[model samples]
Every structure is written in structure tokens, then in C-alpha cells.
Target: MRPGELVPIRDDAAPRVVERIALVRAAGAVPLVGDPRWSASHWQQVQDAASRAEPDPQIAWAAVTSGSSGRPRIVLRTAASWSSSFPVIADLLEAGPDDAVALPAPAVSSLTQFSLAHAAEGGPRPLLPRGRALVAQDFAEATVLHGTPQALRALLDAEGSPRLRAALVGGSHLDPALRARAEAAGIRVVAYYGAAELSYVAADHGSGLALLPGVEADVRDGELWVRSAYVAARYLDGPLRRDGEWIASGDRATLRDGRVHLLGRMDDAILSASATIVPEEVEAQLRTLPGVRDAAVVGLPHRTLGALVAAVIEPDPDAAPSLDDLRGAAAAVLAPAHRPRRWFMGPLPRTASGKPARAQIVREIQTGEWVRLV
Candidate 1:
């Protein structure tokens, strides 16, 4: 395939794949681009669009990775390089032919490859045709299931089933309450951690998150750095290669008991005078409070403290609780640094994938839109 080849692509996969194909084309590498959802004529349109664009001789192979929200950036990886991680996922999931799997739409994520491998265990496992119609009935016989945290919650809520032996949760943080429910229902829910840059770095078995074989990770100065076989070639916008190896992730983590516990992003940490405030720690404490359904804690720019903690929370509608009462509940178990000095009610802004939109909310606060009602 030469640059601007009109390959019929399908939207059935994550948007990242399409973006990757585009990046390759932009770099003078040819790609036949078409959305699977589109007809032949539409494919022609895509091809024409690519054909008309001026090509750059030196385009980086790195794909722009999209988080749950925020801007997407390039992360270079060859098809062969990304596929190497799949077999490990296959082994971890123990996917078999008899094992049916239910996947959310845009099923082309790195983790979803586990389901694909499971289906392929037989000659060809039937893919649950793309749609929002995936219900308990859809996967009554499915032994394996995979989805983003929010997607899984919706599936479990609308059709909580007891058939699965294993479930993979990723693309965002998993809520403790959601975990407890899935476990109670006889489903072994595993929290998966990885970025588009590296697929399936670690996953929880029935026991807990264990680093996949051959993947190494370490915490330095409270930030997580990963050296693995799955890393991409280079950033789409920047030069390929840094130092020698290893990408310094924005995530902050702690290495305890031979496992990495993610502690939010290092850039988002609030440096208030002498004390460093971790907003996620405060948010976690708030979520444990009675009547708090969902919560996000962020630092509001402050004149003296440098940054002060501000919490935006969703109260359980059934409880109809007050902020004072919620704070009182948090007081018993939370330290002062973990308490929100300011509180706002209603839904927290989340990414399309449903992680808290901390960056967006922080911007709103800085612009004086997120007013403190309590």
C-alpha cells in the first residue's frame, strides 16, 4: 500500500487505528483508508481525500494516543510490533472456542484483542455484531468479557449477568463499588492498566494486578516509567527516540510489595507550600464517604497555598445527602490534606471514556466557572 491508497477501513475498531493509518499516510507511507461502516463509494471518498493531500517526506510513525479525554498524540508502532503483545493476553485470559465474549463497540482496542484471541481459539469466534444492543441475553453463554470501566458499568447495570468466569476492565480507573458488585455476582473483574503506547502492561487476575511476563516497570521519584517490548517508535510530533529507551509516563505511582499502585498524574500534583497534595488520594477518600456516588478532587489556584483542594461530587440520588454530612463521614477516616476545602455538587466532568476530566475542570476553576457552593 502506497501513501493515499484508498483502503476500505472500518470504524469497528478504536479511532486510534484510523488516526495511525492517517499518520502513516501523512509520512508518505501509503494506506487505503475507508471506514468499515461506510460503503464502497464512501471508501472512495476517503481515498480521494488522502490522495489530494500533500505528503510529507519525513512523517513519524508514532501514533497520537488519546486518553479517556484530552488531545490525541502520535505513538509510532508497526503492526508487527503491536501484535506481539496479543498472545500474552491470550494466555492470561485462557480464551477457548467454547468461551463466548461480549465486547463494547469500537472493539479494536489492545485489550479487546484478548476477546478476539478467545474467539479465534475455535476456527472463528463470532464477533457480537457492532451495536449498543449487547445485553445479558447477548452474552448469556459468554465466558469472557472486556470493556472500558464506564462501558462495563453500563453493561452490568442494564444486564448484570452471572455467566462470565473472567472480565477485563481498562481504559480508565475502576471504581471500588463496581468491583465489589462484579465480584459478588461471581464475575472475576480484573483492573487492566496500559496506554495506547503499550498494551496490557499489567492486569488483575482473580487475585490482583500482576505485571505481564517480560514487562518491567519501576517507580522513580514517584513517577512510573516502563521499559517493555510494546513501546512505540516515536512521537508523531517529536523526534523518534529519547535517551536510549523507556518513556517517562505522566502517571505517578508507588512500588509497594512488588506492584505499582497508580497515584494520579505527576503534572497534576498540587504543590502547596511544603506539603505535596495528591488529588486522587483526596478523591478516593471522598468516594468512600456515605452518599457519595462519584467524586473528583482538583487543585484550585490559590494565592498562598499555591493550590487548594476543590472537590466536585455526585451524591447518590437515593441518599439525597448534604455536603456537610458527606464531609463529616470523610472526617472519621481521612486526613486533613485529603479533605476538600471547597465542594461542588452534581456530576463531575468526565472524559469520553469516563475518567474524571481533571484538566478540563481545572481550567474551569482557573477561569472562575466552577464556583464553590459549599
Candidate 2:
């Protein structure tokens, strides 16, 4: 498809999804997919951006980011970029022609759209349910399930877990306890680390996530750099920092024994009292503490320290651990400055893709929307 030709898919119906896929793959047209819940002005902005997008003959599909951090941008991907991973992923899932793939998320999400395209390639077509609420009976004939960690948890919470051949969980970090519980229910959990610009970087079946086949990964300084055939060409409004074939992923990681252990995003570091703190590292320790159901950590403005570490936690129903208890639990794992000075207890706000909305949570805490528990 030529540049400046964009097809916006605003509908989530099955027919519309099928038609859009055909246009992109069969007819060689670039299809732009965005969240249907977006406001009219947002759609207008997308249209304007699409019109101004430069032509790339290799571009096959375009998708908007979830905008959890800020305004979303359009990313362009080629057919070969994604298609190369479909066979490998399908092999991992043991998907066959008669086996159905259940996609609970809307087609607007890049993750869901990729699953749909993967299914269309020689596997059974994916089942797009109306809402995120999925039941075991909904995918009785399906063998593979794909969605965010939060969505999968909700489905399992609502309806007892279904025995599936494989469940692909991404879009957010998967807690170890959650993965254990899902596996206990007879589902093979396959967790992956990826971005909107990079389709599939690394995946973990049971062990830690290793770089996928045909992908090269390295840690430059602390940021993860990935080079693969699956990376998108470019973003419509922003530039992807590139060093030849390698793209700098903003995520921080450490390579040990040929495996990538994600630390957190480089941009999420908080400079407090001359000490650098990664909120995700603190949050991981917080999740391991007793009575903590979920946690989110963010930096708030401080007079002397520039920024103060703050945390929002959701306590277990029958066990509300106090601030002192939280500190005691994390005392062995985290540094004094890494611990949260201000703490709030409640459910953490999340984006459409189920990632903790860190910016929004910080805003609420600063505006006093969430009462300080500590």
C-alpha cells in the first residue's frame, strides 16, 4: 500500500475486523486501528496524523499506543515484521487449524490486532468477545488465550480457570503468585515482554524470558536494545532511536546467564536525596510483603529532596498491613530511600491495557484524591 492511504477501523464487530485484515494483507493497504472509546477530537488528531504520515511501501499495519503515559502515537509495522513470529508463537502455543484462539481484548489494541493477524495465518480465526469478561465456556473449543495480566486475572476470578493449551499474558508485568495460581489451575502460562513498536522481543514459558529466535538483544548502559526483523519501521509522530538495526527500548534490564531480567523503565527513575530509586523495584518488593494485594509506586514533589517516593497499595481483604508493617517487611530488600515515605491503601488505577497508570496515580496523590495512609 502507498503512503497517505489510511483505513481507520473504528468498529469492533467481527465483520469489520475480518474486512480490515483482508484490506491490510490481501489488498496491500495500511489499516489504522484505534480505541473506539476515543473522543471525536482524538479521532480527528489520528486522521490528521495519518494524512501527514510519510509513505512506506513496506508498511502493512498502523496502530496507536495505549497512551498510558501520555498522548498516543501511531506506529507503522510491515507484514514480515509480525508474520515472522507467528509460526514460532503458534508452535509454542501448539495451535492448529481446528484450534481456536480467544482474544478478549478489542481489536484496537496492538496486541489483540497482532493475535488476530496471527490467527488468520493458517490457524483458526480468533474469537473476539464483546467485553473483557471471558468465561471458560466462551472458549470451549479454543486452545490458546491472549490478553493482559489484569484481564486474565479478572476472567479467572469471575469464572474458575479453564484448562487451555496455553495462555499468552503480556501488556504488563505478571506477578509470580498470579502465574503460579494460573498454572495450578491447569493452564500453561507463557509470559512475553514486548512493546507497541516491537512486536515480540522475548518470551518465557516457565523459565525466565529469553530472547526469541531470530532476535538479538544487548544491554547498552542499562537500557535494553533489541534488533530483529519484527520491529516496526517508524512512528507517525515520534522518532524511534535507532543504531543501525538495533532499537533502544526505554526499559532497563540486566543480562545474566543469557537471560534478560527487566529492572524497570529508565524514565521511571526517581532522584531522591541523591539516591536513584526505581519504583518498579520497590513495588516488586512491596508485592512480596504480607497483606499486599497490588502496589504502585511513584515519585512526588518534595521541597528538599526534589522528589519523594510514594506508594499506593491494595491490601488483602482480611489483612491490612500498616505502614510500619510494610516497612518491616521490605526492610531487608529495599534501601531506606527506596521505601515509600507516603503510602495510600486502595486499588491502583490502570490503563486500558491493564498497566498501572503511574502518571495518573501520581496526579491523584498530589491532588489529594487518594488519602495518605502513612
Candidate 3:
């Protein structure tokens, strides 16, 4: 291994991923880590793509985005870009030498891999699972946790991991209802809004995501643009857009009272009857419904309306919510146009990183049979 050399590290084992990433850095090579869980061909596609990527001398890490919608993207950043945030994040998350971060998720995700690297550099010790799925034993020594909303919910449902004092959640929206529940459990939930490409945007310690130090942000045409010393140097495909020092975050948001309110990905907007509906805005309200666990809103094809506002929900197993129930709850919070015209209930497709897979759900709804809720 040499500086600027591309080293392919194929291993999905959580412990090994941490070890290998640290090892690769010491050897001065860019570790292009692939998920061993991926089929050989899929991994090959990633490796082949990386082969053509122009080498960067300062690059220390390379990772593929969780391709939930389309082709996964390869991103690059220097080791210091992440290390620079550790001291601040440690204070924000309340991480200490006594805290052990339990990481039961797959190793390939940006958040997971980042935590591994973070722990190695004295953030917190990472408690990795020895098996494919997390069990009670995985969290025995853990005190603090970082996960997506879905993963956090799973942790709450499962037994053990009792030592958890705080949870640092990201990668998707953390429902206000869910955050309330976590607080009731005596856990300090700190939800942060960020992109894999743009590492740490803003963090919320129960209030709302305010800009972290060293990060500058603004809104233009309803989309968020950020300029920070910590952002990724470039995407493996090409350079990121920069207007002066700021780069478009690709998220629709509003800057109200110095808080960053993420609507959703710019691409997740639903066009129904000439109105633009952000699915996240609706989904957040829907998740507050008593029986709803998670929700995904999409533009379902309709001959008369072009695309109807459709909602696919992962309902609570104990009490499945009806379409009328969701409508009634959403009436006060959401506009009539933003309300879901049609409803569906199912397991709700999700990506590896645990975000709702809108693209896959659209495909399944169009071709496959989902239990439609009336």
C-alpha cells in the first residue's frame, strides 16, 4: 500500500471493518471498502467504478452511498475532515471513556463506517456484533448509541442494551413521537440532520438542528446549501458543486429562527394536481398517528391526476391504523392537498441504512400486491 494507491478492502464483519479501515490508513492507502454481504458482481461493479475514479493524494477513505433510489455513489474525504469534528461531537453527544457505542448495523453504511473510524481516534469504544443480526449480548457493555430512527426503534423493542444513556440519531428523520418515547425511557436523544457527502450539518438536542461550529448554511429556492471545512472534498464521480465555498446539500429545507428544517430529499417531492408535496412533511405528521410505525409518501401514477399522493405505512403490529385514522390526525397539521389520497400498509421497504426505499416501494406498488388500506 502506498499514498494515493487505491486499496480494495472487502469485508463486512463489523470488527474487521474497524480494524481494516484503521490498518489501511496507517499504510497510507485509500481503502475502497465493499460490503462482503453484497454479491460478487455487485462488489465488482463498485470496484470497477472505483478503478476509473481519478486518484486524490489527500483522500483517506472511500465509501459507496446506500443506493436506496438509484445507483450508489462513491464519495471521498480526508481523515482530518472527520477528525476535526470529534471534539465538538463528543461534547454534543456526551460521549466519554465509559461510553461504548453499540453498532449492530451493517458495516458498509457511511454512518457505521464513520463511527468505527471515530471510535478508533478516541471518540468512544465501538461495540460491534459478532453475528449478522444483533442480539441481547451485543449491547451488554454499551452506554451510548447512534442509529437511524428505524434502528433505534428496533433497539427499543429488543431486550438488553440497558446501559444506554444517550442516543445520537441521524441518516433520516426522527419522529417527534419517537423522540418523546426515547426521552421517557431516560435516554438523551440528540437527532442530527446530515448528508453522507456533507458529514455533520446540524444537530438537535431536543430543540432543532442548529448549525454546528465551522459550518455555514443558507437557503436558495427552498434548497439548503452548506459551506464547511468538514465537507467531503469530492464525490468519486466528480467534484461537488461549490458556489464560492458553499455546496448544494440536495435537501429541501427552511431556515426559520436559525433552525434547519429538512423537508426531504429534493427528488422525493410528489407532484400532485400541480402542487409540490414534500413526503417528509406529510410522513412526519403521519408517524404521530397512534398505530403508525414509519411512513413513506410517494407520487403514485394516476390517469386523472397525473400522480396521486400515496402513502405506504409500516403500521404498529399491535394496532394497525386505518386510512381514515391517518386522515383525521393529519387534518390539523397538514394541508388538504398534502393529505394522502390513497393509503397502503405493509412491512415498508427500507434501504440498508434504514431509510424508506421510495424507489423500490414505487416499483412494488405498481407491479406487486400490497395490502391496501381503505
What candidate 1 gets wrong by more than 4 Å, as runs, is: 3-64, 67-71, 108-110, 113-129, 132-138, 160-162, 206-208, 239-241, 269-374
| Tens digits of lDDT, candidate 1, 1-374 | 44423232344544454455445445456333223433344335444544554444332232223211111233445544455665665565566555666666343343443344334334114345334355556556667667766656666786644667667777665667778877777777877777666556787654555787768887777877787877665544454334357767667887777677877667676643223456666677677778889889877766434467788888799985686797776655444444577887777889999889988988987787766766
Total backbone collisions, model 3: 0
Model 3 superposed RMSD (Cα): 12.3
Model 2 lDDT tens row, 157-240: 766335465788877667777788778877788999888887889998878998889888999999999999999988877678
Q: What lDDT would each prediction earn against the true structure? A: 0.59, 0.75, 0.77
Tens-digit lDDT track of model 3 for 1-374: 77766677776666676688778778888888776655455567677887776666799877776442113468888888888988877887789666799776666666777787788788788887777776767887888887777667767788477888788888655778778888888889988877677889999987889999989899999989998877888877778877888989888999999899987667676655434576776787788778999999888876434478888989899998777877776654555557788789988878999888888888888886765676
CA error at residue 2 for candidate 1, angstroms: 4.0
Candidate 3 has a TM-score of: 0.72
Number of the top-ranking candidate, with lDDT as the measure: 3
Ranking of predictions according to TM-score: 3, 2, 1
Off by over 4 Å in 3: 68-71, 269-374
Ranking by lDDT: 3, 2, 1
lDDT of 3: 0.77
